[model samples]
Target chain A: MRSLDVTKTAFSNTLRSKMRTFLTVIAIVIGGFTLTVTSGLSAGINQTVDDMLAGYGEEDQLFVMQASAMGMGEDLGPGPQPYDPEAGQQSSTFGQEMLSETDIEFIEGIDGVTNVEPIFFVSPDYLETSGGEQYTLNSLDIPADGPAMELVVGELPERDAMEITIPDTWLTMLDADAEDYEDIDPQIALGETVEIGISNLAFEQETVQAEIVGVSTANLAGIGGAPMPSYALNDELYEIQNSGLDVEQPDAFIQAVVDVDDLEANEQAIKDALQEEGLVGMTLEDLLGIIQGIIDAVAWVLYGFALIALLAASFGIVNTLLMSVQERTREIGLMKALGMSSGKVFGLFSMEAVIIGLLGSVIGLAAGLAVGFTANTLLTGGDGPLGGVGGLTLFALDPVALGLIAAVILVIAFAAGTLPAARAAKKDPIEALRYE
Target chain B: MIIRKTESIIELFMKEGVMSTPVLETENLVKVYGRGPAAFHALKGLTFEIHRGESVAIVGKSGSGKSTLMHLLALLDEPTSGVVALDGKPVTKLKPKAVSGLRNATFGFVFQQFFLNPNQTVLENVTLPLKIAGISKSERNEHGMKALEQLEMADKAKNKATDLSGGQKQRVCIARALINNPEVIFADEPTGNLDSATSETVEDILFGLHRDHGITLVVVTHDEDLAAKCQRRLIMQDGHIVEEQTGASTTTPTAARVPAAPGERPQEQPSRRRRLMKFGKGGAR
Candidate 1:
């Protein structure tokens, strides 16, 4: 029937008034932007949490060093000859095996362990640069050929010696002479001694010369939560360093960090093994709890702004539709005179509101992107708290969030349009026809 | 106008067609504005009938209920009491939607102010009744063009009705009334806003509708001359029909006095219907 066709025509025709239609669309778009961005940020934060709890990648082999088994620096022997490669690969000149009695066979029995090096290590003192910057050094326990061990320069240190591998942080904080370390070939190496300082404030007058060998990159222990303890190293004064701790042999070698098949997959088992071996490591629980705190903070902050924008846009729609009712009084009366029922007139105005809403959402996406991009770039500079956060989060483009924004804007427009549309539909034709 | 002369002969063999059918019937209709004792009674016990193909003029002074009676008959307002039947169907009790449908389809209305949907064009105004009734666009154009052709305003079809002169606008209003092929035409002060010349043109179009197409027409007017020119005239006073004039003869009686017998004026032939009322029959009316 033509009535149905006329309804669609009416919807299009109502939007034809250019100025009024433009304003209506603007109101809706603003509403859409508020709704889109708020929901998107919430969804984005949630997805990040899920990705983090998972362990390592799909392909890799691993082994766990329980209780001091992975400790590499504890065994000192042969009177500082590890700096010389002529020392045997398994010289066994050191008195004690770093592993306990039973760990060797038990670890070997599990399948797919192509090789296992029972690693050993000791805690060392904080290494201090001439400028007074301090950092602790960590040891590498994997094979010299293993993927975990990388040589920045020189060669891997041998067994039964004072020669050691220091992480990147230890090399970075140096005196002026070591600062311009561009060429490693003609640069420094082990047996070429440099002064290292002790930073114990109570007895802070200690300084000794140590030979530098291989350089490692696992220096920032705070980041991955690797273990560290204080110890001083000096090639010329090695006898004096052990004389202060003063024992022919010390007994505590009780921790190990096992590199697993997948770090995240075996995190629970690693945690269980550490419990069995009386050791501890950082776990996913700590990461998740911290992320949850950040998520709550972001949601409340964005939600506050969105609610304000939505309220303003809602008011605009109501005001615009009300003015329309007043402007078209005679036209409404004429429609009634031509035999249009109140319900049909109501439907026409409501459809007009929907058109306005859709237009606004489209425009809002553009406007929001403009503001979001500029704001994101400004926040992206690495000069403030939480600076260098990822790119302006694409809030509006998220599907669920965009859908929700559209739904909310349309509903707001529909609701705000009701009173004015009803008023137009219900005007008495006789009185309206008589109006000027 | 001469086409009605031909129908005078055709109705002779048809007794049912002789008296024709009353397209509009009213029985003691009343309208009271406001509520309780303060209500102003606009119409009181007004009764009338208009036959098919009849042109009627209702003339009265201000406040004599001509407009009120017209509005009630137009189905725009509810009558406080009594019945109104149009073409054998009771109309006084139908719902609002049904009333609008019946009026849009069956009755054409013109007003003194030339309420021609000022927002629309002359052609659009004429086509509105068809549109309201959900007629096809092509058919609406066809019927609207035909109505405009009848009024000799076809060339001015695209002009806005509000832009036309009172006379030209009324011509478009006449075309609008006929576009739906209404069974009855009701006009309230149709020429009241026009000059004498324009008023005559409107009256001419209405008379042509009745005579050529056999369509019924009822107009409420204060102009004595306009009222006097119709086939039937009614004078109302304070909601009462004080005077009425039956149709002036459209034909001359060929026979004198007696012998041809009782009720012989209407011819009875084999091909026509019996003396049956096409509209109201069973009630006391």
Candidate 2:
């Protein structure tokens, strides 16, 4: 018989015992649904991390600090230790291990290090628009060569300019009479000037005027949606905050951003060199590796469950086909006697199994996508649970992964069908015809 | 020895001016059911030839090897030792694919049970042989409709096989058997499951196809009246053809001798006329 006829007949035959076929397909559907959803979740998280990293900084730059700055180092073996005079030099107002000018010079001399720029720690107390209300402000320094921020309305501030970019959340704060935050437009605040107040060493507040060059969208990265100041503006603020002190101001910073040549190939070498100098260096991939590993582990565990469900579903297919073969013994004999080849008979049953797999996977794909997109909408909405984490997408479908899942299910189903199909093919026409 | 006997019979037929060619010829065919001591010899060195356009009946009681011989002749089962030739070609040596191909193209069968796929429509049932032969759908439908029309069952083509009456089902079977335009039609107790009226209708259809189309007919039955309608009858008993007769004479004047074997049934058997009278009396009820 022609292959098309065999396939058509096999599809029709699957409908003979509708309930059994439906139950088997449901088993496969469960597996496909789980696999699709989990893979989508993994893809979404990895994509979100990548987007966040792009906004963080340049790929060829590493953030380096004293090894004990972030409480990540060898065990200190208890609370207190004998204090060395050099310990005092490592201390700063920022209450962390600070890098000094000498440390920057030392890093600049490293083999792959092209340049080092100290990340000036500046805390502006409040921000006030011209003739407008004052609002508490947390600020970050924008490096001269850093990656561009995800801007919502305007461009990033020019290098070495006394300019600032505020998050969209500060738009309403910039309005003096706006009762509703939604009524304030972000574009109006783009060119406005704001005063940044910083406390000096003598307990007096110093103010500096800076232009709002842009308005950026809030995201989980970018220092928790803080306003950003250009390197020139940050330097002026830091200088003013330390004036009128009796003690000499230590030329130290919390960390330094180091540029390197060929970050992909020399990142580990640069990091190891820094480690020998009692410092730690982290690349973009290094910061995201732990998160990626966790996501991958969770995806693999879910895939294991899906595979187990598919294994059980394969047995269901075998049982269903075996029963069908038993019931159709006489029919098989009649077809064989009518000159249908054994290969055709085998093809018929295998085709039936594949049809069942196709039905299950297609339905599962539709179901998974429906749930995935719906969850994405609900969770990413302003009033939803994940709204606090800006630009978070919980599920993203991968078309290639979906196709692979369906193909795997089909292969499993065909393998499961071979036993019963072989039995049907081997039936003796005489004995089968004589069967009651 | 059996070859000589078969040659003489063929010579006799030639003398009678039948002028027909033999479509199926078997030489010393033997069939055993089991191994060694447990074996049941179904056909013991039987030799026969069925000619083209001839209606031959293999009449015997149950377990008398008539069905076995028919299966062997139809290429449905392999014989223990013998040659079953179709159109002078030894088919037993052919591969299974070739054997099924020959059966599909050249032979048709009607069984005691209708063996129709109950869920399928009558047209689908009738066109099964053509479908197995990989004929195109449009052509299969055209040929199937024509066969159904010949059986006067065109209106029932769309009806499920299970919905048909016994006589109608038998007619559908005849339609199926005729759809392939086979050279020979093998009917094994074609009317065994029908009433007298239905059986008569079925018998008429079988004989009509034989008479009108000149398709060779091989029927296996225990009914003497059915056997009487055939051109020739071979009466089997215990794995051997005990008597052979033609429609022209009730007595077996050209009876083929049974080769003698030790520890077997006697060569001398009851008269063919007496057996016919006995079966005819029983069949009248």
Per-prediction DockQ comes to 0.26, 0.60
Candidate 2 local lDDT, A1-436, one digit each (tens): 7777788788888987899999999999998888889888888888777876766656888889888886765567998966755556767655687888788989999988898889878877899889767888755644442353557677777768989888777777777588754467878988899999988889799899999988775554444367888888889999988886888866777888888999888988988888988899987666666677889999999999999999999999999999999999999998888777788888888889898888888887788888887897888777676764656778897888888988998998899899989989999988899888
Docking class of 1: acceptable
As a TM-score, model 1 comes out at: 0.63
Residue A335 displacement in candidate 1 (angstroms): 2.2
Candidate 1 per-residue lDDT over residues A1-436, each given as its tens digit:
2656466546655565678778767656766666555565555455444433332232233334333333433446648644523222212224222334244444444343334344434323555543466555322233322223334555544433445454443443443455533323323433444444443223333555445556543311112112111122222233333344434533212222233555556556645554464333333334354665677677667766765676677677778777777776766775666676677677667666766776787788667656655554455444433232322132224576666677777787788778777988888766676677
Output the worst ten-in-a-row residue range by lDDT, candidate 1 chain B: B276-285
Residue B102 Cα positional deviation in candidate 2, in Å, after optimal superposition: 2.2
Residue lDDT tens for model 2, B58-92: 88777788989999999988999989988766888
Candidate 2 residue A388 C-alpha distance from true site, Å: 6.2
TM-score of each: 0.63, 0.83
lDDT of 1 by residue, B1-285 (tens): 224423432332242243456767888787888999999977777667788778888766667787778777777777889788766557776667666666666778777777776656788789877776678878888888888988888898887777889988888878887887777788877887888887788888888788888777888876656665677766565666655655543132121121221232323333211111111112110
Model 1 off-target regions past 4 Å? A1-9, A12-21, A39-312, A369-396, B1-19, B136-146, B149-161, B247-285
